[model samples]
Target: MTSQNKSVPAFGYEIIRDYALSTILGKHADDVLYWVGKDIARKFPCSDIQLIISFFEDAGWGTLSIEKEMKDGYIFQLTSDPDLLNIKNRKFRMEAGFIAEQIQCFKGCLTECYDEKKEKQSVVQFTVKWDTKEKIG
Candidate 1:
């Protein structure tokens, strides 16, 4: 199918992603979604940050940007149109998990990601940290 045909409306996407999944999975939704995101990353791995950014856009997640870099980790910001930004109680754990897995693959180390929701600013910030001492073979 063409990209346009494959596209899903924001409301529809939200209904499934936020509402349906939460309703079905309940309190476990976030954790399950996080692992699902990691599985997706493993299936469609991105070797570079640019590819990751492109993936986010193509998936209609949002605009992903690097906010800061640290010795052990990096900070990322996600922003979207008003439709998504205005969503009530939207969680970004999936996105965080995706980034964590991607970075772990890239850095060959154990990595974890935490997300902060800035509802007032309509933004989500992710902090990705890796354990340099624990390398993956």
Candidate 2:
């Protein structure tokens, strides 16, 4: 398929995301998408948190904002534009997994990510944590 404009509309992309991906992946959508995100992070490694935040925006994932940074981990929140938020048709596990892998690779330790979706508030929060004592070699 070729487009004269060379840019697909956001609605078109969402259609593929909502229908194509779900249809293809079916029951394993969540798990597979998460792995795919991790794979993407591996291929395009981010050198710093700034790059990670930019990656999210550039990829049309959403706006990533750091809420807090703690000794062992960090908390981030993702929010879409008001229009997109009203649509309520997003799958963010992919983002969470991507972040988990990135943090794990960067810190050289075992890492985990937890996502909380606040539909009412139109926000998705991701908590990424790594054990400093546990290193990955």
Candidate 3:
């Protein structure tokens, strides 16, 4: 099998990521990672909202689903099995930031995203909002 096709241990990746954010990044890790996520989103542009959902699944981030849609923005829910629930909040910020940036870039407008963690449900809810009138990026 190709090196790129090799499967990585999820625990190893998680611990490394958590360590980098906690030890290396320190208090500002969340903000830094959020912007980093936006940069990543810009690098990998998605054509549509559905593609965003697929991206999440393909990346092993989570199962993304639309919880609600509004004129200004959308609400998405990310759910995963209980076994994958050990990730830090900072890691999730990366996801929220990525989705925000992708939507903003796609719509050519300013977009902001926020996430709510439902620990009991093993779910995260992301709210992405954008200004309809200001379509310039």
Best by TM-score: 1
Residues 71-99, candidate 2, lDDT per residue (tens digit)?
99999998988565433666777888899
lDDT (tens digit, per residue) of candidate 3 on 54-132: 8898777879999999999999999887566553433578888899998998888889999888877878899999988
| Greater-lDDT candidate between 1 and 2 | 1
In Å, residue 14's CA in model 1 sits off its true spot by 1.1
The TM-score obtained by model 3 is 0.90
Write candidate 1's Cα lDDT for 29-98 as tens digits.
Answer: 8899889889889998999788889999888888999999999999999999857765356778788889
RMSD in angstroms, candidate 3?
Answer: 1.8
Q: Distance (Å) between predicted and true CA of 73, model 3?
A: 1.0
Candidate 2 — which residues are off by over 4 angstroms?
1-6, 85-87
Error of 2 at 7 (Å): 3.3
Q: Could you tell me how far off, in angstroms, the CA of residue 45 lies in candidate 2 after the best superposition?
A: 0.5
**Model 1, residue 120: C-alpha shift (Å):** 1.2
lDDT of each: 0.87, 0.84, 0.83
Which has the higher TM-score value, candidate number 1 or candidate number 3? 1
User: How would you order the candidates by lDDT, starting with the best?
Assistant: 1, 2, 3
